[model samples]
Target chain A: MAIEKVEYWRWTESNWKNPDIPDWHGSLITAGVDIGSTSTQAVILADGVPYAYSNMRTGSNSPDSAISAINWAMKDTGLTLEDITYTIGTGYGRVNVPFSNKTVTEITCHAKGANYIYGPTVRTILDMGGQDCKAIHCDEKGTVTSFMMNDKCAAGTGRGMEVIANLLAVSVEDIGELSFKVDEEPAPVSSTCVIFAKSEATKLMRSGWTKEKVLAAYCHAMALRVVRLLERNGMELDFAITGGIAKNVGVTRRIENIMGIKALTPTMDTQIAGALGAALIAKELVEKKRAKEG
Target chain B: MIANYGYEDGSGHYYIKIDTSKCAECTAKGCISACPEKLFATELDDFDDEVVLIKEDARNTLQTNCARCKANGEKEPCRQACESDAISFSW
Candidate 1:
């Protein structure tokens, strides 16, 4: 594959604030918070369109990360936290989101977020995060029907990338870009654990493999694991890739080739998908509350 | 019985002793994989030297007491991850 440089426009809050108006749909302002293992992200939806998004490093205190990201987004959009009509939380620490009216599972949130971006046609979704890998299946309504997650193993998750990153002295961000430039995808290195994976990569380097090949091999290995998960759940049409992995063009291409479907990645806010789903759920809950009051 | 060394005052007491000689050249690094807490870290030094050391949190957890290491019996995951089989309980 020729390495084509696709310039991704920066998602600044200022640009989102003045988004083009929808043809006829009225907009509703809602918020979603996702508390990931290593990071937290918040997204605000205005009439089904994402108008604000922010990401930050997550600390042991999940609520703090959630609140901080929300504050940052609100600050950027000049909206107060109280201005949000509803808020939903998802992820490992969803229960810790203090202001959230309710918490939804990450699986459900990811499915909804992907469906919102790609329409109701998506079948399989690969959400690879720092501490876990999730392959989810959903119906046209964006409700999860089946899902598989590898939370117990660090080898198939973002931790594996971090370990390799440290070994190669390359930032995790650079690994994806370098992988796109490899001439030939090297032989797959076998190691399901972070420590073993590093050891295997080290040996490959000693054996005269170029860094690009090694990175390509790593990306393939990671993608293969996700592919297996998707296959186990039965691959369906209109597959989409989400989570942090969706950001890596190299890995996404490899996955797309294996699955034979062009994986759709959201242009607005991929990382905030979970949070946006949560907020959407929150909006539903709030409307129910208003109905009872009326 | 697990061998634990610590001070009751809870103010200052720690254990920092690993016989590198006895811990040298063992191939069964089960501890590296078995530790759920991930308190143990190992890296290859130069050519083939496996430098096994405790992580910061593991250091703190085992600080005032090295019960797991001092006891020469029972199955420890840390000992399992060690492929070299160099790490063992030292009394």
Candidate 2:
């Protein structure tokens, strides 16, 4: 029998303009660019409020990806690079953002982003990005108090999910919902390494395990792996999840079940957290500079 | 078994190298407990010998994770804890 192919997890790229943005004829136009491994994002702030933002796939060139994301964000807005008073670069390709005024680690940016997205009450953040995962503890203001990151392994990351998507001919976006259609939660795959897990999944397929069953196993394993990282960082209340994995209900629900805490629902795209945080930081830097100059 | 942890960006290259040749002789595995960030773990290598390895997630962010040790101008806890002198940082 021929296996059918489906592209469920391919989320559409979006550029958004906040309807409530105020007229800022003389306000500082700050921006943040997050050049991640798999996706790039740019967020623009009018003074300290979000104005516009874009999220897209990162290309082979980091500098080009940063510029492309920023241009897309500014496309609908009557803005240009010169209009941005300060720019902060963040994520894996952070240092490569040629036009940025400074670079901030993704950890700090994610904390700040979580604070803005979920409100200042959020104290814990779990950012599951393409190539890595971060568990962060922060103050009410989104200042990182402690953080732990897992970048070396792909097991609990978006990339790992993509690998499974290709293997099962399922859409990356669809894996989460499909994973839950099974009669019961299958045992998690034994390996924590993506490469090894792939082999284990193939073995399960040979044994007549259904695609949803295999996916359920993988999603459970991914959630469990991330929880280990979160436990190491120490769990705090008001937990929020950022990055692409936040949209995967299969993994997010599993994570909530394991942790016994529900994650705050984000009003905006979860992927924008890093860039939004960077933009907020840009605003702070520009204001500090102005105060010092005065 | 030389394992490297770090990434190369426009600014520069940052990595932490752990030589498993030296790690094979370690009986204390102090690096696993000494790293405040808990970036080390003991695992069985391909040859079926147990060795202390730096968690893969910790490799790319060594500069950021090891900042506290560097800022204090003190010997890195992981390096100091290693009796085999297997760990080194390249910033």
Candidate 3:
């Protein structure tokens, strides 16, 4: 018998290229690849404008994941790796990006990317990635003044959401909408820890609590954990959310309700912010090098 | 002004807060060489005041970098080097 494959927590892997700008001739092409713990995103920029990008699940090997992401992003775009003037690697696996010219911290990349994606007004950013959550404060130019991460816990991270999605037998993409189906918000679970939260969910299930209610409870707890991180780091106006969790309406809505501030909407996929920031930085680095050479 | 470095996580809080007001008065800047892990550095901050700060790259790796100090039962060499009470750690 073959091993059963689980698709519950599997979000779609995809690539996007701007159809409006099909040509990249004479443009300074740059690429940024963000190798996160759970997902990898590769973004290609042409003359400082986003040209192509890919978001995919990270593989077991970080280097290999980096390669796959860039290739997928450039698929049929007529751009090769050598065409890129510079490449910056970022995120949890930043050091493992074999083809990058430099590496940057996810904290810096997120702030820069948010400014671009959500506009220059974005001063506060909350990024809940695969295995960690970070809150960042940036200036008008996207310079990071301060930041903090939920470094030691999976409580407010995407990994915790995946586990719950798997246990609830709901597609991770659909779970957020399902969570709101509950008639009234259930009280948050007793524990913010993922392991303990899982056990609490099990107990709730045994007590005949609906899956939707349990999901609401869990998302509420997760949002609270995220709020604490943001408050500690200091939140500013024109806030935005990035990473996998940003796409989860359940978590984002709850966060807004608690903080009394609406998160800015991005025209592009929020998950690509880190990689986008890297690509933008790659462009900057190339210009700096050119100036030095002259 | 107090500048807090490092982070709080699931396990516990780990921070190295530097009182820049006190740091501004110190010309010796001894903390730069005191850390065994070379985690400290000096730079002119936003106010153009020279002060000791944790290396930017070193901030995220404090848990591992400070482990050696804890293992040897010599908790903080950097704090001891700061004669002006400018450096402190939250563990």
| Maximum-DockQ candidate | 3
| All DockQ scores | 0.02, 0.07, 0.22
Model 1 off-target regions past 4 Å?
Answer: A1-28, A292-294, B1-91
In CAPRI terms, where does candidate 2 land? incorrect
Error of 1 at B9 (Å): 44
lDDT values, one for every candidate: 0.67, 0.86, 0.86
Cα RMSD of all models vs. native, in order, equals 15.2, 10.8, 4.6
By the TM-score metric, which is better: model 1 or model 2? 2
lDDT of 2 by residue, B1-91 (tens): 4455564333444667677768877889899889999989987653346777667666667678888888888888999999999988766
By DockQ, the candidates rank as 3, 2, 1
lDDT at position B27, candidate 2:
87
| Model 2 agreement with the true structure over A82-174: per-residue lDDT tens digits | 999999999999989999998887877998989999999898889999998888788988887655666666889998998888898888888
Q: Which structure among the candidates has the greatest TM-score?
A: 3
CAPRI level of candidate 3 = incorrect
lDDT of 3 by residue, A1-294 (tens): 998878799999999999978877755999899999999999999899999999999999999999999999999689888898899999989989999998887777888899899998998899999988888888888877666665556778899998899888889999789999998999998435789989999899999999999999999999988998788768889999999999999999999999999999988899999999988888888997899999
Q: What order do candidates take by lDDT, descending?
A: 3, 2, 1
In terms of lDDT, the poorest run of 10 residues in model 1 chain A is A6-15
Q: Look at candidate 3 and tell me the lDDT of residue A159.
A: 91
Ranking by TM-score: 3, 2, 1
Q: Is candidate 2 or candidate 3 better by lDDT?
A: 3
